[model samples]
Target chain A: MSTWSMALRQSDYYWTLYRRTWKGSVFSSFLTPLLYVLAMGVLLGGFVEADPSRLEGAPSYLAFVAPGLLAAQTMQTAVFETTYPVLSATKWQRVYFGMNATPLRALDIANAALGFVLLRLVLIAIVFVAVLAPFGVFVSVPAAIGALLVSILVGAAIGMPVYAYAVGVPNESSFSLIFRLGVIPQFLFSGAFFPISNLSPALEWLARLTPLYQGVDLTRMLSLGTWHTGPALVHLAYLLVLLVVFHRVAVRRLAKRLAF
Target chain B: MISARGLRKSFQQKGQEPFEAVRGIDVEVRRGEAFGFLGPNGAGKSSTMRMIAAVSPVSGGSLRILGLDPATDGSQIRGRIGVCPQEDSLDTELTVAENLYVYGRYFGIGRAEVRRRAAAQLEFVQLTERGGAKVEDLSGGMKRRLTIARSMINDPEMVLLDEPTTGLDPQARHVLWDRLFRLKQQGVTLVITTHYMDEAEQLCDRLVVMDKGLIVAEGSPASLIAEYSTREVAEVRFGIGENESSAGAVESAVGRRAERVEVLPDRLLIYAADGEAAVAAVHDAGLQPVATLVRRSSLEDVFLRLTGRTLVD
Candidate 1:
């Protein structure tokens, strides 16, 4: 088989295992988006005043935060998928070693794992979009599709680096630190909850430097049908570049770590 | 099927001197033979096995598997051989059958073919009934059988088993051995590494005894015994620490019949062509012993004679 097909076949292992647990994941994949749309958008959004100018032409707070929540959720999913699971496969369960004993190389294992993560990101994006669609959160069909694609890109950008880190860490103790200092901070301060312009100027600049903020901004613009060509390209470029660089780095790290 | 010359492996941790695991050992395993590497822990057996399995890189020296250089064609080499590592690398989350199916898929086997082989292998390992059970739910022996079953999922030409029965009970080991013996009968080349001498005797056609990262002796089981040890051994125990002081008497008592007397803290092992005659000589010399027994010599004696230490220790 070609290397690409071999990698795809390797990913089927994860797919087989995932089939046993996807039912239990309904809480995060389906209900989390529904809860966020209802509790945060419908209920909490009523208390906040909608300012189309400041909200970048969004009709209401619900429309504004829906895509941002989707982007944040994607980041969270990507981080969750990459951290403990990658470590467990590399160390505890040694699934990668088992595959390496076969015709699959380290590159194939990395590609297989990353491909599985991307498959999950796409499924979660679909659920998030479908869940919020009836609430009229998106302005157009193209906007919904655009936000979905951008969310998956954002997930890849965040997840690939986390995978590299996961492969290098000696144990799970560092995972809590990553969640506390890295993932949690990005979730709270990366323009997912409010406009970065609303934060202090320094904090806003720092937030803009984060990949999630770029995703959130692009997703929100796409959802509200207010994105411009130049700024959208810039955000897409940042996310695309981050995704490619970290993906290559993750593949290299897996190869190095599995080289024992 | 496998060849190596001056094969070496070293590990270099940061800020520490490099530690050589396999120190320049030459080995050859022909096709259709059950070969073994017999050694204690840290004897470089696993390291050598990894190189042959095409997983670990050779630190230095030349090695080849199925005539392919691992440095350039590792995946190709791996495609033709199966490896059961010392540690259990089986996926705990997967079911028994699922593990086989997934591992077969890694070899790029078609889904239908994987399913067919998975069932056949499960039956081969006598785990057909446990196919749907989670891997963690099985006992250690069952898990090991499942691992062996998964190793055969790709229908590999050769199988490398590192300590295949290390933690198994005697019955479990026997069951596993029966399965492995069946594989050998089917013409699959088997290369095993083990600390247990009986396992080597039971399964291997020929073996190399390793110690301190070096091959100390190499031959068939009986040949090595003939070369390094006598036909039999007489064990005489004078009770506890008394055996140490009684070594001189025991050695002098048996005389020429006792080719050598290995004194331990609790007993004296008198090597002889006739173990009962050696024990009778000890009695005739009026050296009173608490207990006595005679048995044929084995690979253990050969290793002890070569390394001057026990294999398991």
Candidate 2:
């Protein structure tokens, strides 16, 4: 088999597995984001005034937070998918070993897993957009589509590194530490809830450096029609670099764990 | 077919010396024959099997499977061979049939072909009735059977089984052995690794006895037994500490007939051509044991004679 064919064949294992258990994740992947929009945007927005300048060109608090949450949702999906499921395949269920025993190489397994995560992120982004369309969160159909694509890119950028880290983790005890130290902080401070400028100078610089923040900013700009070419390219380049570098690391580490 | 010369595998641990799992062993497996690696746990059987399976890189020396170098052509070799690892790495999320289907797909088989082969394999393993059941719902034996069936889904020319029937009841083991026997009869090359001497004798046409990362002896079971052990073994059990003290007396009692006497924790095994005569002589020497039994020598005796340790522990 060709490399792409082998990868698709291996990913078909994940696709078959996901078909049986995808319903169980609907609450977390879909409902949790919608609830965040409801609680943080609509109910909480009523108490705050609509300040477009401070909200980074958004018309209301709901408009400001919803698009950023879309980006954050992508990050969350990517993070959640990469951590436990990656570990389960490598260590618990040993499905990666099973795949490695076949014609599929270790790189094929890694690519297929990351590809599945990307697919899930895209699906979740599309559904999140469709679910929030009536709320007028998206300013234009083309911009919304652009935001969706950027969300997936941002997810893969974050997910790939986590995939690299997860393959070598000894057990599940370390996953909570990733969420507590890495994911939760990124979600809270990465321009999702508010602009990073609200923080102190040092923390602002730190937030600006995070891929999640870049993703949030890019996703917000695209959704609200405030995108700037130079800054957009910078954000896109940052995410692309992280994605490429970590994809190499993840594939190598996966080979070490499964093929050795 | 598989061939190796000075094959070695070692694992490097942090802040520690590297542990050598396979210490320069040579092996050759012919096509359409059942070959076995018999050893206790940590004897490097699985490591060697992994090398043959092409999932693990050779730490040193030369190795080849299906006439292709594993380092470069692992995917090609894996495509033509099947592996049932020691652990049942079956997909718990998919149904029994779906597990087979997914594994077959990993070989790049088309969906219709995979479905057809999956049905045939499930039927072969006598799991046709439970095709739609969740894998977790199956018993251990059934799970192993499913794993074996999954291995055969691609119609591989060679199948590698690592401890194929460990942790199974007698009836379950017999059923698995019967299935493997059928596979052997079908002219598929079989490579099996097992600690069970009976399993080795029952299924393997030729086997190597491995211990402490080296192959100590290799031959057909009967030939190895004839070369390394006597025809019969007289087992005499005494109360705990009494067995060790009685070894000398038992050996002397059997005289020239006893080739060797192995004193285990709870019993004394006297290797002799005539076990009944050996047992009678033990009684004649006024050494009475709690239990006395005479049985034909087996591969277990050959292992005990070679390693000074039992095969299972």
Candidate 3:
């Protein structure tokens, strides 16, 4: 079989196992987005709508923050899917070694991992948008699709590097540090919650240059339908470059870790 | 079939010195035969098995699997070979049937074919009733049999088993041995690495005794015994810690009357073509052994003769 198909077959293993636990993941996949929209969109958007000073460019905070949350949640879902599960397969459960014993190469396993996580990212993004749409955050259908693209792109960018780190960890405890230090800060400060323009100039620039911020800008512009083609291309370029570069790093790291 | 010439495996160390796990050695595994690597732990048995399975690289020597070079044709070689690793690495989250189905997919098998093989294999391993049970719920022997069944999914030409029965009970080991013997009967080339002498004698058509990363002796089990040992052995124990003191008397009594005599801490092993004659000679010399027993020679005697009782690993 070709490497691509072999890799997908590897993912079929994960997908089949996921079927066993997919019911348990209802809270994260469905409830988390529902509550996020209710608390951040309806409740907090009421206060922000009364005060437009905080939300400058948009009509309401719900419209402004929904797509941005879409981007960040995609990142969260992608990283979560790849971390402990990757560790379980590679180290704890040792299924990767079993895969390596077959015709599947390490590269096939790595690529299949990304494919599986992307599939999950798409599903989570769909759930996020489905909930956000009922909350009246998505303005147009094309804009929602644009936001979905940016979300999966941002997720792929961040997910690849985290997967590399996940496969190398001696245990699972250190993963808490990734969410606390890497993901939580990006969630709060990456223009998803509020405009980066209000932040200190240096911090704002740093945030704007990172991957999630680029995703936030792209998704927010797409959701609001106010994006200029030039800036949209730039943001898309930023996320695309990060995705390509980090995917190479991820494949190499996983291959090195799994090598005999 | 598998062939190796001067196969070596070494692990590189960061700042410290590198360690060679398998020193250069030659080996040939023929089709339709059960070949074994017999040694204690750390004898580089697993390392050699991994290399032959094509999952591990050979550090210094030329090696081939199914007539293909592993360096250039690793994936192709692996496609035709099955490996049952020493560790039970089955997916616990997957049921017994699911584990086999998912593993077969890695070889790019069709879904229907995988299901078919999974069922047939489960029945072959006598785990048909437990197909839907989770791997964690299975016993150690059951897990091992499942592993063996999984290895047969690809219909591999050669099966490499790394201590396949390492942690099994006597009954469990015999069951696995019986299944492996069936595979050998089906004309599948079998390469097994084990530390159990009886297991080696039972399963292997031709075998090599390894010690400290080297092949010390190679032959069929009985041939190894006849060459390195004798037809029978007279084991005489004087008492706890007394064999050392009585070594000289036992040696002189059994001298020339036996092919060789080894004084172990607990007993004296007198190797002779005839154990009864050797016992009479021991009594004729005015030496008294607290306990004496005679038994036919086996692979353990060959190992002791070549590697001595001192553990190399």
* Model 3 regions lying over 4 Å from their true place: A49-56, B280-290, B310-313
- Candidate 1 structure quality by residue, lDDT tens digits, A27-144: 7789899999999899999998967877767788888889889999999999999999998898899998898889898778888888889989999999999999999989889989
Candidate 2 backbone collisions, by pair: none
Better of 2 and 3 by DockQ: 2
Misplaced by over 4 Å in model 1 are: none
Winning model by DockQ: 2
Encode model 2's per-residue lDDT on A46-66: one tens digit a residue: 787957999999999999998
Consecutive 10-residue window with the lowest summed lDDT within model 2 chain A: A25-34
Best by TM-score: 2
Tens-digit per-residue lDDT, B188-282, candidate 1: 99999999999999999999999888999999998999999999999899977898899998888888987999976668899999999999998
Instruction: Judging by TM-score, tell me the better candidate of 2 and 3.
Output: 2
Q: Distance from true position, residue A116, model 3, in Å? A: 1.3
Per-residue lDDT of candidate 3, residues A165-221 (tens digit): 887787889799999988999999999989998899999998988778888888888
Query: What TM-score, computed on C-alpha atoms, does each candidate reach?
Result: 0.96, 0.98, 0.94
**Least accurate stretch of 10 residues (summed lDDT) in model 2 chain B?**
B86-95
